[model samples]
Target: MGRRTPKKKSREIYNAWNQTCWIKGVTVNPMVTLEYNEWWSRRVNDNISRPNLEEARSIEEYLRVVPSELEIIKQDFKKKTSELEKKIEQLEEENVYLKLDVDL
Candidate 1:
């Protein structure tokens, strides 16, 4: 009955937050979702009666930084790729020297 209103409003917040997360291509982590829930509660005290689209959108943007492991992996990939390229050049130089010696 009357109880449904608060529950529905809460769902609106979760829906907006989840939708924004989906659009931003990030996993909906519990910690961030709980922060959103707390923010919604505080906004209710400020006479905001509906889920805030802007708030949800901003949360997604804030959480969108590349994860630390992914950054480390990217750096490692660059290092390994450079090392492999250098090794290939060295091998090619040695092959040229071997060919010259064979001709001699």
Candidate 2:
């Protein structure tokens, strides 16, 4: 009987802890729901106003993204690489001609 009593008491404590955990886990705030509902209704019902012509910007200006310093450096490097490649090709052609002239 004594052993049974301890087991029953432990079971009751476990049930109570589980109940508290279940209650804490559920978020049932009616105030937050009401505020969100009100905001949603206002957003859905409100009229969208047109932009003022005086302050309106062109789509191209609004969408244009400025290149960063890294991007500018990459472009310069690419140009220099292409120029060096062309010079290498020219030197190789001259070497081939010089080799042919020596053979003849």
lDDT top scorer: 2
Pairs of residues clashing in candidate 1: none
Give lDDT: candidate 1, residue 14.
97
Q: What is the C-alpha lDDT profile of model 2 across 1-104, one tens digit per residue?
A: 35668889999999999998877667545335777989988887776676799998999989999999999999999999999999999999999999999999
lDDT (10s digit) by residue, model 1, range 43-64: 8888957697766677677888
Report lDDT (CA) for all predictions.
0.86, 0.88
lDDT of 1 at 60: 75
The best candidate in terms of TM-score: 2
TM-score of each: 0.36, 0.44
Query: Against the correct fold, how does model 2 do in TM-score?
Result: 0.44
Off by over 4 Å in 1: 1-67
